[model samples]
Target: MVERYAVPDHQWDMIADIVSPPQKMGRPRRDDRLMLNGIFWILCSGAQWRDLPERFGSWKTVYQRFRQWRDDGTFEQVLSRLHLRLRQDGLMDLDTWM
Candidate 1:
């Protein structure tokens, strides 16, 4: 069954590199995939920060990471990369009507 707010494996694989970079320090990072799910959940649900469900990890960590990415332009970078990927795959039609 599909979990709410979870990223699909296929879709995640396409943009994982852009959104979830390998952190090169102290210890291995928490699962970026799960953190992303938590991020999407908050944004999509419009839930208050304290209300975040625990399965996705500490809401505090997720929120902090979200802010970091937003400030760093990673979101824009990911969108551009995904758009390019879609174009390459012919999934995006650039027809005049579109």
Candidate 2:
């Protein structure tokens, strides 16, 4: 029996709700959520993508997804939206002299 890890429902829902629907493509598709999460883990942890754990799935898949998101502007959009929300919520401090 393959064990499936549970991504926090709120976090998963936030990502699903914020991200644009995967674009329609002619080719058969591969799972994107695993790849996106793997890439995000690497970025958040400041670790090498190749060092991503097997539990996260293939490093190549994550790298490919990262590149695709970059090319498609998805990553930028997500970051921009997050920044905007943080600013609106007063969670982002812009004070330079601390």
Candidate 3:
């Protein structure tokens, strides 16, 4: 069954566009939220990959994508963008966050 770790709309809305895979002449990207949720589930549940809920697709796929994002700096880009937005809105203080 689908679980709570599946990213809800509001949380996904914040990072959705940025986290989406870049479109190319290849397989259409899987839902970014699903993948993110899969990652979250693993981190939050602290389970073996084989234990990943099937609703999240194969754990290997999620693992590969997570590794890809980490290696390619996608996480940094997302953080940078979020920081910029928060700074513009006076919502994020590095002093407090750091």
TM per prediction:
0.83, 0.63, 0.79
Report the lDDT tens digits of candidate 2 across residue range 62-81. Answer: 78878888998887777777
> What order do candidates take by TM-score, descending?
1, 3, 2
Candidate 3 residue 96 Cα shift, in angstroms, is 3.0
For residue 36, give model 2's deviation from the true position in Å.
2.2
Off by over 4 Å in 3: 1-3
What is candidate 1's local distance difference test score?
A: 0.84
Candidates in order have lDDT scores of 0.84, 0.69, 0.83
Model 3 lDDT per residue over 1-98, tens place? 44577776775678877788468788787777788889889999899888999988998989888998899988898888889889989998988987
TM-score head-to-head 1 vs 3, winner: 1
Q: Which candidate is the best by lDDT?
A: 1
Off by over 4 Å in 2: 1-7, 17-28, 93-98
Model 1 lDDT tens row, 1-98: 66987889888987898788878788787788888888999999999877889988888998887898889998889888877888899888767324
Residue pairs that clash (backbone atoms under 3 angstroms), model 1: none
Q: Name the candidate, 1 or 3, with the larger lDDT value.
A: 1
Task: Give the per-residue Cα lDDT of candidate 2 at 42.
Answer: 86
